[model samples]
Target: MKCVVSGGNIKILARAIQMLSKIGEEMFVQPQEDSLSFRSVNGSNSSFADITFHENYFSYYAYEDLDESDSLKCKILIRSALTVFKIPSLINKQIETCHIQLDANSTNLCFILKYKNNIIKTHLLPILDCETIRANYKKEGTVNHLCIQPRVLNDVVQNFQQNLLEITIEVLKDKILLRNYIDETSNLSNETRTQLVFGMGEFDEYKINSNTTITFCLKELRAILHFAEILAQPIHIHFDCAGRPIVFICKTLGVESNLVLATLNPDDDLGSQSTTHTRPNSVLKNSAKKPTKAKGKIKSLSKTVFGKLANKYPTNTNTEKIESSDKISNASETSSPNNNNKFNATNSPRVNSAKVIASNSNTNKRENDNSSKQNAFSSLLKRKSNQEIHSPDGGDKDDLVQNSPPKQPSKKAKLIFKKCFQTTFNPESLPGYNNIEVEDSGESD
Candidate 1:
């Protein structure tokens, strides 16, 4: 058997095979006198899928060598088939036609895909001698029928809570309900369950031969939903009762796919036996609010300090304090009076030490300026000495090197305050205006 497929049809066929692979690990490929067929049943026998393509579906169909009653069948791994069509862009673009040939006597199937620019790819897959599956399921007496657009039904199902194991579909007078099928044996209250309900107006056509409700596994239905590509069109659904597989059929302009989802049996008498008993803690848990943690807390650099007054510190103070925090100590600064006088050149130099620490912004800025100037002067003097050393005669090099003063000690920054004062102070510097109040003493007359 040989045939060719190209254009968007390639994507349609590949997506179909990928979908079928989800229902089962392997597939049965059968080519007859008029059309080709694909079928599979899951390991649990709970679900089955079958798809067919007639001669008209292909651009060029020819199987004249085989009789109408003859059937050529083969079994191939799902992964092997999926890999060949994995690149979707190739299908909708430059691909010309894909040629497939089934070998009856050989042990493998050959697939040759031709593309533009003379590019060609050929793959061989080993075939297994597995029997074709023929599922016997009756659909004549189905009581409930619903024709729904894929988009509308998808919008409703997406709202259901994700943790549900199964979904229960119920049909009533003019409305339908899709809800989480909580096991009656689990003792879960109905209030804790999530339900999605819609009126008959949502469906294109709704019919019921008799009132019916069915429950089925949610995962299998979701696996089938991967073919939302075909769901742009409407999907037809029909089922008989509980514990029987429901039928889902989606047909596009070119191809059609059919899926059967097995229903779960309801527990017997479990709900009736627990109607009178109530778990008190369960009620409280159901009504309680769920706790949520904030992702991150915002941090502010400025801190409020409580002293004689409540005040916020400035950002510059915090920056310097943070930068110099690792190197603040008495040993970090020299107590030499000459060095202090040199730094404070405008002030008098003395044999005594200078121990004044910078407490405010003004003092800190002034001290930082003085320290920068002293360092710049030293650097300038050293540069001049190096120039003299490099001179033709190199005069007075020894004197210049010996006269340079020693490097100044590292600068120290402190955050302490010696005093605090507020309000107006008189020109006489009144004691009442100061933080430290002076005691009044009078001589006895």
Candidate 2:
């Protein structure tokens, strides 16, 4: 049989052939003709044919007439190929158990196999030569040739080759888009898309309109293409202008993913831009200027007042002692400074002593004032001693008497006579005095 095998299947078949060659001869020897007759070799052959041929006519014919060694070799090669391809050969061995179903165009094939009560159809590419085993066996005639594809398998091979290219392109595109997502570094603010474009000028170039929508000019598109090529990745490109969302354009595919474009919220945008007013240094400068002017005025006024007071009460003069003494004596006798001044100004000397008399009078007045003060002090002591003896509250009277300076003898004598007259002349004493007066008058008359 003529068979064509795929590169993948060929490798598997080669490995299987090598393994079968290693088994010892006895296990795979063909029976002698006499021994075959006694053991019913024809019956065995018929049974094997019936069991294996029930599936595909190709495998049945390929294995039916084969000697024990050939049959073993065929099974080994087929089993190894199926194992490498990850297909189950044991279940497919039953009669009519597996069949390839192809669409009218023959681009796709579905392998139909029965398992339990249900039939399962697995979709596969129809590009393997094994699918056309009958044609391969017809051309090659050797049973070993049918081990892979038994005939020319060019049509299925071509279809598989082409489909591989398409699958690869699709996978590559997906990988690129994923990489772009992973490596993105631009932290575009979620402001309006227009603002994001402007902010990300270094990464992308676009023109922003008054409406805040951004349009990618030709130059910007070229730059984006170059960026995509450099990054070898796909990216999601969007445009926003002012506060409105615009349809985004994808570079690799013009179609957009089902994503909601971002729009700016009026309240949020306004709140974000609002800031507290910070008073400038100039305000503090103006405030500082006023205080400096006030301080200068205050200092000047204080200096003027202090200077005037200093001149009036010159510290160099010795008038303080005489003035203070006069003021003290006047204040002691009067209710106020005005009353004291009136008393002093009204007082006059008894006689005007000119020159010699003035000197002598001054001396004499000083001596007399001193003597009078001493006598007054002695007389005050005598009066206080007498009051202490006569007063009912003597302890308090004594304390007051001790604290005060002496009074003059005239004052003391007047106080003593007043007290004596009051105590001695009661009404009864008055009658006796009057009778004495009457007798004395009678005698005189």
Provide the TM-score for each candidate, comma-separated.
0.56, 0.15
- Predicted candidate 1 versus true structure: per-residue lDDT over 1-445, tens digit per residue: 8777766677777777777787878886767666666766565545667666667678876665654322356677878888888886566586777877775555777777888868898988778753454333433346777888877877787886666556778777699867665553343324356566699998887887666666665665665565645536677787766545587777665565667666543321111111211233332222220100000000000010011001111111112211111122132234333322211221122111122211112212222334477664565566455532222232222212111222345322222221224345343564455565566678753
Please estimate how well model 2 matches the true structure, expressed as its whole-model Cα lDDT.
0.23
Write the residue-wise lDDT of candidate 2 on 4-54 in tens digits: 222222222232222222221111111111111000001101000000111
Model 2, TM vs. native: 0.15
The Cα local distance difference test for each model comes to 0.53, 0.23
Q: Give me the overall lDDT of model 1.
A: 0.53
Give the lowest summed-lDDT range of ten residues in model 2.
37-46
